[model samples]
Structure formats: C-alpha cells, structure tokens
Target chain A: MIEVKDISKRYGDGTVALGGVSFSIDKKITSIIGKNGAGKTTLLRILSTQLAPSSGTALINSHDLIKNADEIRKIIVSVPQEAKPIQYISASDFVRMYLSARGFGISEAKAAAEKALRKVGLWEFRDKLTAELSGGMKRKVFVATALASDADVIFLDEPTTGLDPFSRIEIWHAIKALRGQVILTTHYMEEAQALSDDVIMMDRGKILSKGSVNELLKGFDGLVRVEGRKRRKMAYKVGDVYVSYVDRRKAAKFINEGEIIRPIMLDDLFIKRGVNLES
Target chain B: MNLRYVAGYAWFAGVHSVKENYPYLIAHLALPLSLIFIVGVLSHGALLPFALAGGTVMAIASDGAGTAQELTYLRLEYMYQDFIVATKTGPIDYMLGEIFAGLPWVTPSIILYFALDAVYGMLTLYNLVMTLIVSVLLVVSVSSLAFLLSSRMKHARLIGPYSLIFSYAMTVLPPTFYPFNYLPRWLVTTLAVFPTTPAAVLEQGFFGLEPTAWYMLGILALEALVYFAMARSFTRWREK
Candidate 1:
C-alpha cells in the first residue's frame, strides 16, 4: 500500500537522517526496530507525508507525496513519538473537532470516536480534559483518534514507549486489531516479535535487515541444552531438527533415559548468533 | 465559504485560548482599563494622544502575543500535526479560524475605549465606524502576519521579542500619538509604507480628516493575500 523509493533526508548542517532508504509496506503490521538515532522515526514520518525527503520519492496508494500531499493526508494517520493530547480540550470534543475538520458530520465523527475509544477502553473518560489523564490514558486517546479516523494507512512512532505492561498490551492488541496497513517503530524487540508480520531493523540511517521473524531467525544456528546432575551447558549445532547437546556422559545419561529438552527462544538464539544483547 | 467549518475551528480556538490563557485575558482587559483610567485622570486632554498610541500599541501587542501562543501551543503540543494529517481540514481553514478567534477578545476593548470617548463627547458615530473599520483591518493584518511568522518560526520564544518590536514600531513609527505634519516628509513616507500606518491612517478618518481609507484597505487586502499565500506555500515539519 506504500512505496518509499531511495528516500534520503539531510539536515541543513549536513546530518544524514535517512540515506537512500527504500522499503514497501502492505496491509499488515510492519514494525521498524532500531537503536537510538537509527532513522526509524524519520522513515515513518516520510511515509506519513509529514516530512519531505531531500531526494527520492514516497508514494501512498500510487499518489506521489510531493505532488499529492493533500490526497495522501486524507489516507494517512500518524501517531508521533511524542504524541500528546490537545490540553484544555476534552477528549470527546477534541476528537469531534478533528473529525469535523476532516469533513465528517458531527454525529458521524462522534459515533466513530465513541466506538474507537470504547475499543481502547477509554470511552468513559471521553469528556475529561486530556491533560488530567495518565500517560497511558493519553496515549490511548491518541491511538483512539487514529483508529477513529479510519485512514487507509496508519503510522505509529513508538506507540508504547512509557506505558505500563497492561496498557502496552492493550495498545498492542488494539493495533493488532486494526485492519489497514500499519507502519510502526519501536525499540521493544518483544513488540516487534509479537505484533509485526514483518520486521525492519535499522542502524545508522539505513536498513540493516528486513524480513519475517522466521526468515530473520534463519540466520541464527539452532542450539540444544541438556540439564543433568549439577551443571548445565549449551550444545550448538547446524541442523533443521532439534539435537541434544550435552557432555558425552550427560548425553549418554539423557538418551539412555529417554528425556526431552525444551526448544530455545529467539532471544537466546539472537545472543548465540553473535548479537550483543547489552548493546 | 465553509462557515460551519470556520465556526467550528474558531470556537475551538477561542474556547481553548480562554481555557489556557484565562489569566492572560484578565490581564489583557485589566491592563488596558487601568491605563485608560490613569491616563484619563493624569493629563486631561494631554493624555489623549498617548492613550491613543498606547491603546493601539496594546491592541497590536495583545494580538501578536495571542497569535504566538496559539500557534506555538498547536505546533509544540502536536495538535497542528494532527490537523495537518487529518483529511478534512486544510491550512486555509486554520488561518481563517485563527483570524476569527482573535477578533472577539480584541474588538470589545477597542469598542469600549471608543464608547468611553463617545460618552465623554470625544467621538461621533462617524469616528466610531471609521475606527471600527481600522480596528478590523489592524486585527486582520496582524493576525495574518502572526500566522505567517508562526509558520516560518517553530519556537515561541523567538517570536515574542520580534512581535513586541513590531507592535512597538507600529504604534510609534506612525503619527499615532502626534500630528504627521510635524514629522519629516521622508519619515511620513517611510511610515506610510507599513501596513499598520495605513491602518492608523484609516483610524484618522474618524477625526474628520478622510485619510486614504481605500488605500489602507487595499494594502491590508494585499498583505492578507500575500500572507495567506505564503502560509499555503510553506510545508509543515512532518515526521519524515
């Protein structure tokens, strides 16, 4: 649904934000993961038609970003990394104003906003000033606003940055339930693993890797762990089927006794694949 | 003219402004009232020129401050980006909304001051109407200028001093306090080049000296047109 071709962004003093980055996103959750200053937010902003790239082109549903920004705006909704509620306005009133501004009738906007808020579990607090709400609730308001807009594509930049576990899960589920194409960025590896159909890892203003979880896991060698008497160690091997890695004596003890070990998780596999967990 | 949308945004802007800056509103009204009374008591007729100049200064300063606050709040708080991404409203809608939003707070004080002048037998209906027209032009021109500045400058701190300077210049550079005849011809011509000077000239029309209302109105219209065009031409700083 979106095509970004060779997009590059350079600031006035020569800070390269995105260097000829290119990617295509379809009607599924595409999670962009990167370290700090990796240009994930920049890529999402470009896709949302918020920032113009210095060179290259971005197309939303076949419309050129520069030539057809208004049309692209109609179909794109962006949840900025620092998304905040419009203080002094009630949540319901803010949503209604936004909808009305967008050309929807008051009743229609109200209905959609109510439904969207209810889905995010914030309908009861609709009339409260957004500034009075907690961080999680405010984020929910922004999420609800985007969902209510019913745009063809939604870009969420760090949607669950400061939320509690429950609120994060709720937001993740809400995002999971969205029907349109979604491009989201986050530092949370678990979120990318849980919600995204595909993942794009970025580093230093470039795409380091892009693929499904299974495809990404292919780069790591599978490992087997054998737990015996007092000490436990990991045995690494190259194969499709799971193998039992243990000391010769432990292997004999385990295989002879017909015991089974659990499969390794992606986190462990990632560490085993020479990815520095601390960094 | 999409009055419904215009009204919606105007209502949004006004209500938000009131809620956010209620203290400023109180101050906005109180400061002027205090100044008007003090000047009225202190200098008899001598204070009229200073009061007029000060009132004009207050009006422009208030308008600029209010506009800066509104635009800065919208941009920094991410409200502006939300509106930009929303399919329904354009930048023109925001511009008109801001223009209408700023009028009510500014108009009442100007009218009240002139009404006081009338009660004291200082102004006639002709003066009232001309002053009203000039006030409207001033508000429109300042509002447009504010919007243009907001679009160009991202931070509010930088805008405050610049806007204050402009307001000061608008009030003092023209013959707002004293007679233009006393000033140098070159100075008068230079002042005439400013939109605020023409607006002040239009206000002079209320005093029985029909000073170029058409020219002032034409300049205001041209300025509004240029500002609106510039506002439309500028691209917002989006996520990309």
Candidate 2:
C-alpha cells in the first residue's frame, strides 16, 4: 500500500514540478498520464524513493519516504527513463551484476538473471553485448533486470516508449504478471486504459482526475458525438473522425443527411478534457 | 554508505566489470609497462628506480583512483548510475564500485613495475612494500581531487580534454619524474602542496636515498581525507 498527502516540489529557480498532488494505492497497477512538464515523472521519482519532495509526506507500506528511506529501498525497484547499460557488458552479465548489487548471492543472482531473460524472451540474446543490442532489445534488458529483483513496489517510467507492438505487448504482460504495487507513467492513452486498474490524469503539476476507465467513461455519458465535416463550437476534429460533444437533443438537431452518431472513447474524453498528450 | 552486506556486492560488481573488459585491461597494463621500460633503457638504467616510481604514480594519477573517466561515463554518457541509485544501491556503494573498478586493472601493473625494479637488484621487501603504499595514497588523493573536479563539467565532450590536461599536469609538473632536489628548495616546497609530490617524496625516501619527513607523510594522509570529502560534496545523488 502507498499513501501520499499534499506532495509538492519547488525547484531552486522556483519552477513548481508538483503542487499539492496526492493519491493512494494498494497492490494494483495504477498509471499516471500527463503531457510534458506535467510533473508525472516527479511524482513517480518521489514515490519510488529516487527524489525527496520539498514538502508533504508519503508512505510505502507504513515506511515514511524520508525517515525510513533505507527500509523502503529494500522493497522497491525502479526502471528510470534515463537508464542505460555499460557498452562492454553482456545483457546477462548486466542483470547479474544488478541483482548481485541488490543483495543476491552469485548463484542466486545468475539463476534469477536467466529466469528473467527467459521470461522476457531475450534468452537467446542474453550473451550479446548490451550496446550491440537494438534499442528495443536494451529496454527488454532493463525490464528483465526489474523483474529479477522481485521487489514489492516497482516503478517503470516509459517502459514501452521505443518498443514495437509485439515488444510492447510482451512488456505489458510482464508488468501485468507481477503481484507488486506497480506504478507507471506512459504517453500512450490506450496502454494506460488497457493496463491500469485506475488512472490518474494530471495537468500542470496537479492531478485533474482519478478513477477507473469505466468510471471516467461515465462522466461523458448521455453526451452525443456528431461526425462528418460539420463545424460547431463543440466539434473536435480528431484526425478523420470529426467529433462533436453536445446534448443528445442538440446532436440530434445538428445531424444532417449523412453523418455518424456514437458514444465517447477514452481518447475522445482525453482530448475533450485537454490532457497534455504530446509529452 | 550503508554497511549492509547488500552494499558489499558493489565491490564484486566492480571487480567483475574490470575482469570482463579484458581489452581495456590489456591496454592499461601494456601502455604503462612500455613507457617505464623505454624510460629505463634511455637513462642507461641509472634512473630505473625513478622511472619505476614515476610510472607507478603516472598510472595511479591516470586512473584517478577509478573515478575520472568512469564516473564521467556513468553520469554523462551511459547514465547507468540512474538505475543504480533508483534501486537498492546507495551513493557510497556507487563510490566503492567506482574505486574498486579501476584498482584491479592498475594494481597488477604496479606489481609488475615493482617486480621489474626488483629484477634490477632493488629488491629489499620493506622498501618495495613502502613504495606500494606510497603509490596507493597518491592514487587515492589525486583521484579524489580529479573526481571532485570532473563533477563540475556539464558535457561528455569536456571529459576527454579535462582528464588529459589533469593527467599531464599531475605527472609532468611534479617531482615524480626526478629527485625532489632537482628543483630549488623554494620551488620544491611550493610543489609539495600537490599530493603527487609528497607521494614521490615518500617513495624515494623508502629507497634510502632522500629521507622524507614524518610531517610530509602526515600531510599526504590528511590531503587524501580532505580531497575525499570534497569529492563527496561535489557528487550529485538527488536531482535538482
């Protein structure tokens, strides 16, 4: 379980990365979605014990983030956005060292490394230098390292950022199989919708909303979407699909000779609500 | 650093990294030995001990105690420390890893140089061991200072030029290459402010030629601690 209260971060030059943001979770995959500069990474770093918040308190399994950081480190593992492998080391050796540094014995760390590589379907490439591997493959090594640690609290930042569809699906399943409290941040809305039991929507360093996908879908209920080249105050041209959110009666009134009527998808709601999607 | 056994693994990891990079290890050994041998041959073997001591100090100064290029790469280029710090690895644990990583590669070369000197009939075990001790201190003190200096640089490109200039200055301008008396007393006393100077002084003293003062030895130890503290202050663990 994790608990956060009124978390805020202020930089030396006074740029606020997170402001009074708070949430809680217990053994479930919770995703934080936001655009660039929305404080998503800052929140993850604080919760993962990577960075200390300037104000407010957070607890991971009753261990205070600041006071009991050493204890918290015992149960957590994080795959940060900037992690890379030493060019000379093979992937298996990299994981082996990582696990060893995490307190595993030589035999145990090697065994865990093999299991993790196999789980990620990178066993064949385990002996290859990490630098020689493709970027997507290197990301798999990181994922494997995280899995091998078997930590109780895991934070994965942009795990699927540069991965292909198949590799993304593989990581998705890998993250899903873990029993720990998994907190992730991603730009892909469908991924957040697919993997998270609950999603925290953030904007400008504060959480704009938080709920299950179904609960969030409820907020757009009874609203009608009118499509096909019709320009109105509520009409949003989302690619080829021109969507207009209005009252059912208003949508009916705007309907013309040939047009489509449908309910809202997460993407539509995300665009309507103005969530930062570029980052 | 946390004394937990968990941190001990960094020592293991450091050694493993050095062992795996055999190509680097080979170059590290070959280059230093070749330079010492060439210098020894050119000086008609009369300056063999000076070359040996100078070359040992050069290797130690070159590796910067393990923090120079390695820390630069870990922080600016590969950035694997991000993962380490984000995981169970603490700052001191990471420092230990950096320290141990380069020592194994450099220590063997130091041994070889000492062996070469012994083959030249300078083999009194006490003097040999004392020279080893002096060389290790020079490595630690100068490397700590280098580590502290490297932390100020913001880009990876600056690493090469900065480290080269530092290496050249520590080796060329000091008494590592000659006897302390080669320079006048005023200049020699001024140069003693450098960690490498006292280091060379101690090494030459152990060979029974130029007796080094206990005060010089004490000053070298104190310099090592002070430089280590400065390096710790310069290191950045938490993001701004």
Candidate 3:
C-alpha cells in the first residue's frame, strides 16, 4: 500500500504544481485522470521518487520518500511521460540493458528481456533499431522494460498517449496483465473507466474528487448523456458543445430530437461539476 | 561501485551503441587524422612522433569532452537518465557507464597512433603501458568535466555547438601537440588546469620524446578525482 501526506510542489518560478494534496492507494490498479496542467504527472513523479515535494512526504511500503529514496527506488520502476528509446538501439538491447541496470544477472536479464518482448508482442521486432520501428513500437519497448522488472510497484505516466486505438488497447491489455501494483496517469476517461479499480480526478493543482468507479458513478445512476447543438436549461457548455444529463427513460426522446445519446462516463462528472476540460 | 552495473551500462551505452552506429568510428577519426596529416607536412615529418602522441591525446580528450552532447541528449531528449535514476544505480555508476561508452569512440584512433608508434620504433613496452594509463585518466577527467557542463544545460540543441567548442578548446588551447617547454613556466601552469596538458606532458615524457617530469602524474590523477566528485554532486539524479 502507498500512503501520501500533504504533498505539495512549488516551482522556483512560483508556479504551484501541487497544493497539499493527499490520497492513498490500496487497490491493485489506480489511475490519476486530469486535464493538462492538473498535477497528475507531478504527483506521480514525487511518489516514484523522481521529484521531491516542496512540503510533506510519502511512504511507499513503509519507505520514506525523502529520507529513503534509494530504498524506495529498489521496489519501484517508472517509465516517465517523456521517455523515448535510443534511435540506434534495437528493442531487445534496450530492454535487456534496462533489466541489467536494475541488477539482473546476464542470463537472467536476457531471459527476462525476451519474456517481456514477447509479452508486449514486440519479439519479432526485437532486433530492429528503434529508428527502424514505428513510433508505437518504440513506445512499447519501454513498456516492456517495466514489465520485465521485479519491482513491487510500477509507475507509468501516460503510457498510451499518442498511440493509435489498436495500439492503445494492446498496451491496456499488457498493463492489465502486470502482477504488481500499477499506478498510471492518463487524460482518457475511458482508459480510467476500463482499467482503474480506483480513480483520482484532479483539476488545476488540486484533486476535485477520488473514489472507485462505481462509487464515483453513483451520482449518475440510471442517467445517460445527451449531446447536441440545442442547449438545455441544465446543460453544460464545453466550447460550443452542449451536454445534458437525462434519465435513461428520457434519453431516447433527446436522441430522436436530433441529439446524440451515450452512457454517462467519467468525464460527464467533470462536466457536471463545472470543471474545465480544455486540456 | 557495482561492477555489474558499470559493465552492463558500459556494454549498453558503449559497445552496443558503437555496434549500432559504426559511423561514430569515422566521426572520431576524421579530425585527428586530418590534424596528423597537417602536422606531418608542416614539420617535414620531424615531429611525426609528437603529432602521433598528440593525436592520441587529442582523440581521447575530444571524445570525452564531446560526451556532453550525448549526456544532454540522453537526459533531455530520450529521458534515459530518468529510467536509470529510478533504479538502484548511483551517480558513479552512470558516470562510469558514460565513460566506457565514450572510451570506445577513441579506440580506432588509439590503435592508429600505436601502429604509427611501432613504425617509428617508439613503441616500447613501458611507454605503451604508460600511454594507456594516461589515456584512461584523460578520458575520465575530461568526461567528468563534460558531465558537469551538461548538467547545467536545459536544452539539447544548445549543446552541439558548445560541446564542439569545448572539445577543441580543451585540446588545442593546451600544448597537447607541442613541447611544454616552448611555453613559459607560468603559461604551462595555467594550461595544466586542462587535463590534456598534463596528459600530453606525461605521454611525451613516457616516450622519451621530451624531458620527463614525475609530478605530472600526480596532477592528472588529482584532477580526475576532483572533476568526478564535482560531477557526481552536480548531476540531477533526483530532480526537484
């Protein structure tokens, strides 16, 4: 389990990335969802021991983040949001080197690298340089490193961002198969809904809400979202688009009235709470 | 120090990277070979031994100083350092890894210089051993200084020109290609701050091509430690 207490980060430029936010994760998989500049990445960076918080601290499996970062690093592997593979390195070499750096012996690192490549469906392209692979394939090479690690916790920041729909689904499946606790950040509401056992929603530098999918969706019980050009009395306007929440029984009526109807989703909550979704 | 990490990272950033991009061998050789040719012609082959020895020092020092571009690219562009930072690996491991990676770039040049030394009848067993030791320390000290410079940079694009300038300045500004006595005593002292000066002096002394000095070895070793310590502290392994 991971416990966080009053973590905050303020840059030298006086930009506050996090604001004394606190949360915990005891579930197998938790996704932090937020628009751009929402502190999702900052919180992950701090918890992964890559970035220090301006105030407060966290305990990962009882290891203090600030005082025991080296110990904490032993149990965690992180794929930062901006990670890219070396252009001249092949997929197999990249993953194998990473495993070796994490202290796996030669033969063990090779076998684990092979297993991870196969798991991520990149075995056939293992010998190809990242420059020779597609952008999606290059991204998968890093993901394969995280999969091959023996760490107790894995952190992946926007692991599927910019991927095609099929590639995204493939990564989602790989992430689902991971054995240890997984924490990821994404802006995709469906990804959170599909993968997360629990979710944390952040806006600006603060978390607006956090709970299980079922618990967070309780307020929208028996309701569907109807999006259209015509504005309703209680609809939310998102840049020229108007979205209204209606009872499932009344959803068909709105659909026939030239409005699009869909099931209520995680983003609907943000819209209902008047949260800006520009990012 | 974890020998395993050093060897692993060495193979990854050094041997593996070199194998994938063989053009680096040519890139490393192009400048030094050209300078060797120019010096041989200008001095009518009288200073060929000095030029060859200087070429080895030049090759190794420039490669080490050029590592700034690679480190900056790895840190800012690929974010590879972030992956290593989150591991149990320490700053020294990363430095050695990077050092080994850079050492390979100078291999062809080192071999070329030694072969030329053999042709000129200057390749004694003792000199060969001494030259190798000096080359290794030169790579370490200069690369450490490069790492120190790279850690302060926030962008990769700015590193290319700066590394090129720094590489040439570290080598050419000092008397790597010429006899140290040609300069006044005070100038040599100032140039000693650049690792290549002492490295070149040691190599020249080892080959008996110039007057020998025992204290130059002490200076080179001391500079290596100081630069390595500074780099380890300044590198941003754990970001704020």
Write model 2 residue lDDT over B1-240, tens digit each, in one string. 543323443444456556667676666665456656676688876666776666677677766723577677777777666676666676656665666666777777777767766776665888777777776677668867766765676887787888777766676677775677778988867877678878877777776657765677887888888887877776777564
Ranking of all predicted structures according to TM-score, beginning with the best and ending with the worst: 3, 2, 1
Error of 3 at A255 (Å): 4.7
Model 1 per-residue lDDT tens digits across residues A87-120: 7777876776666666667678879999988888
Model 1 over residues B103-133: C-alpha lDDT tens digits? 6566566766667666656677776666666
Model 2 CA deviation exceeding 4 Å by range: A220-231, A237-267, B1-14, B18-20, B29-48
Task: Give lDDT tens digits, candidate 3, residues B1-240.
Answer: 656678887887688788778888998888778877887899898777877777788998778766888888988999888888898887788878888877677888899889988998989999889998888788888988888888778899989888988888787777777777889989988989999999888888888989877799999999998988888888777787
**Which of candidates 1 and 2 is the stronger one according to TM-score?**
2
Q: Evaluate all candidate structures by whole-model CA lDDT and list the values in order.
A: 0.68, 0.75, 0.86
Q: For the second chain of model 2, what is the TM-score against the true structure's chain B?
A: 0.86
For model 1, fnat equals 0.46
Off by over 4 Å in 1: A218-279, B1-5, B16-21, B34-38, B49-57, B77-79, B82-88, B122-125, B154-156, B170-185, B192-194, B207-218, B234-240
Between candidates 2 and 3, the lDDT winner: 3
Q: Score chain B of each candidate by TM-score.
A: 0.77, 0.86, 0.95
- Which residue pairs show backbone clashes in model 1? A45-B239, A45-B240, A46-B240, A50-B238, A102-B88
- Model 2 local distance difference test score: 0.75
**List of clashing residue pairs for candidate 3:** none
What's the distance in Å from true for residue A215, model 1?
3.3
Model 3, A1-279: lDDT tens digits are 899899999999999999998888889899999899999999999998888899999889899898999898888999999789888778898888888778889999999999999999999999988889876787788778888885789999998899898888888888887778999999999999999999999988798888999999999999999889998989899878899888898777886789999998899878988886873
Best-fitting candidate, scored by TM-score: 3
